[model samples]
Target: MKLVLSQEQRELRAAVRAFLGAASPLPKVREGYDPEVYARLSGELGLSGLIVAEEYGGAGAGFAELAVVLEETGAALLPGPFLATTFAAIALAEVPDKELLTAIAEGRIAATLAQPSIDLIADEVAGESATVTGTLAQVLSGMEADVLVSPALTGDGVIMVAVELAGEGVTRTALETLDLTRGQARVELAGARARVLGPRTEGGVGDRLAVALAAEQLGVMRAALDAIVAYAKVRVTFGRYIGSYQGVKHKLADMHCKLEQAESIVRYAAWAADESPGELPEAAALAQAYVGRACFEVARDHLLLHGGIGYTWEHDAHLFYKRAKTDEVLLGPPRVHRARLAESLGL
Candidate 1:
């Protein structure tokens, strides 16, 4: 239904926006803030253990609040691993396993979704805990994470499990990526000791995270579109603003439409997450499919709109491009979401 934010939610957004503005503005991203430093900042801002129960030293807000934090985080394009860490915290919250939740809530433990580029299957979780054998590439928050949330082939199907990053059988190798501003690591987790968090909540946790990710993508698109539009008005060509050009205006118009649609889907998905989880499988898939593609295209258009100067590392457009691509592959690829969307509707 009504996807508008309540006054409380709006206030929350404003507070978060202001806080992040001072603490994590553009230069923080350009300088590549360290996770330890960022996480410490998050703790100072009372975001480190935000979702854990109050008794456990967290704000106890729930997914809706997390969604707000993420949207603002994306808008600032702040370079931090909070998104992945917080998302993992959500999955951790749902796990009936008390020790895991306790560890996470105390903020003494850090966890990231170890979901790899490589797919995993079920029969691997018969013993004390599930096992993930692949080298999960681009693990966000990995360098600082103590536990990792990964897909496992469990008795109930494809369930997400929490594997300790420091487990005896695990190893990590940091990778250099285009988005050097953000942290991502490749972890070699052969026979890593782990605890299966919950049933292969693929369609739930994975899908829900994807929905939030769509929100993040939407924010990225907004930023990219804003950057290009602002640049167009000021960076004149031939004594006239480039934005006055027919082709440039048309391209900007198309980008604006895409950005608006992506925003709508992102808001709808957030509402679905708050009010109706089960009814959102298709909705989440749809949002991811549309938002992910739109984000990538918008960023690409941003690059083109900037001309030769956009290719430089100094410009922020490339960061958005890399983020969109990484996000596209994060929960599942666009094709995977599209396929799920079609299958859910029996098409």
Candidate 2:
């Protein structure tokens, strides 16, 4: 029931924040994906395997720890395939793929989950593998991923499978998006072979993803609020600091309240993912329902508060705005989560 982070978790946050500050400053993040940076993040910082089992060469942590790391990553706007890889790891954990988990923990491969947008078909299955054919319209980190875990429609039923991206029947094409830091791709599989993972069920992977993303949106809100507040303190208009304006003050107060509420919900959602699975669905829905729109509103205000400079490509305000807007719709918009929340509440 304690929503506050422990001392150790605070230290973890500090460490991650410091590392990102030094390694992934805004300029570096603007440079786009870097393989070496991701390598150090995985190998040196040991974040790639932070939540995998110790026996699988990971830190053997839980979703709480992962949430802490993600909050920092979001604040830093760290680039590359870290989020996608984590999603794949979570999916594999549900099915317990020893070799795949080990590879992810060791940073030997990058992976992603095929979203529902990608409707794959598996018409035939022989023994442990299936011939998969379909096109994933937009895959997060698809360009950099080495493997993909997805649900495919089969004659028997919907089943989960893992496909190697580097295989013969697979092709990938990069796509432009609002969030340049997080790249997307188009994947086409012409009867590519895939290893069966397990039978598809009503697992909480989607809910877990919502919670994790809500954590990131919380970080975005924090960073945006802090940045605008700092700017208000220094920037002057009509011979007075912007912070002295009553309108700005009210907006900032509202943003702070939203951020605090979002943090509370995100923390509870992450906790439920780790300690109370029964509460995860409701908690995740609540987190996304509130946090997504809150983040977008905060980011939008953060940009507007900065005036015209915020619209320029040179300023970092647009970056936060773009990330917030993109993330709002990443797993469906805030309205979708709100509906989910309503359904969970039996309303």
Candidate 3:
């Protein structure tokens, strides 16, 4: 299969990058979320529903389009619940709720998934409803979400549910997190009623999530590498440009190699997510395993390349570093993805 992006896809990427460059610049991202900017992104740009169906009031695009948008967002470090909400929309697409998807497409309701923390207390089976109780200690964008796509353990199997965050028996509290651009929250549910979505699968959700995140990590690595390379070209030390130094050139070369490898894996994984379900598990694992570490390394080097300025609060280098570090652990780290890949390969 062709892994390269089409001309249209390239144009889409350019458009998204330009829009984000002007609207959600690094300074704007540092200032935090802006509702007005997000509205334009969701409504005018039609990003929130890139992967949603046209019948559901979305753009009826594929994962490839969504991946392009994700890369631009990652580069800009756009604030708000775009990633969380888009992820929820992706998860919900498998279940296909018309009204909910429409709401999401319109950017009226924000949503997030309760993962690695939610639990099942009881399954009433009262006409597509279940009673759930759990505390999600680190839900990304949980405080801003209106609904949660939660998976809970059940006696028969694992069931996915859609829980209303504003309903009774639900409480949300913000949490201190490493990434300032992305917020997390603790959600406590006490016998909250939830609408059943479907049975939970083993690798489907995880693989998709991995591919999506890998795309973002690719963006981060590219941004860091580009920034450092540009800085190296001009910054002078001892009356000589840093880019002329062999050591700096070698490091930049290494970072470029990693970025290329990451780009290939991420693009392949996204294509698999869209067209090759059978290959998604392996592709996703590989993408996450390599890209996560590579992204972090590039971001770390980005900071190091900036010298003392990178460590200061004012420089944007720290932002990329923090974002990379947080993303490295957001889905249980590179080791987890590597382990998953090994198991999948029967290692």
Best by TM-score: 2
Candidate 2 TM-score over all chains jointly: 0.98
- Candidate 3 stretches with Cα past 4 Å from truth are 116-118
In model 1, which range of ten residues has the least summed lDDT? 114-123
* TM-score of every candidate relative to the true structure: 0.86, 0.98, 0.96
lDDT of 1 by residue, 131-250 (tens): 677666678867777778766654455676777777787888877876655678888877777776666444476667787788778778887899999999999889999999999999
RMSD to truth, every model: 3.2, 1.1, 1.5
lDDT (Cα, tens digit) per residue for candidate 3, span 1-347: 77789999999999999889888899889888787888888887888878879999999997788888888899888777888888888788778778789988988888887664445554675657889887787888887788989788777777788889999999999999889898899889898999887776564877888888888888988999999999999999999999999999999999999998888888889899989999999999999899999999999998998898889999999899989988888888899999999999999
Q: How many clashing residue pairs appear in each of the predictions shown?
A: 4, 0, 0
lDDT of every model, 2 decimals: 0.75, 0.90, 0.86
Question: Candidate 2's C-alpha lDDT?
Answer: 0.90
lDDT of 1 at 291: 90
How well does candidate 1 match the true structure in TM-score terms? 0.86
Worst 10 residues of 3 by lDDT: 114-123
What is the model-wide C-alpha lDDT for candidate 3? Answer: 0.86
Compute the lDDT of residue 328 as modeled in candidate 1: 75
Local error of candidate 3 at residue 45 (angstroms): 1.1
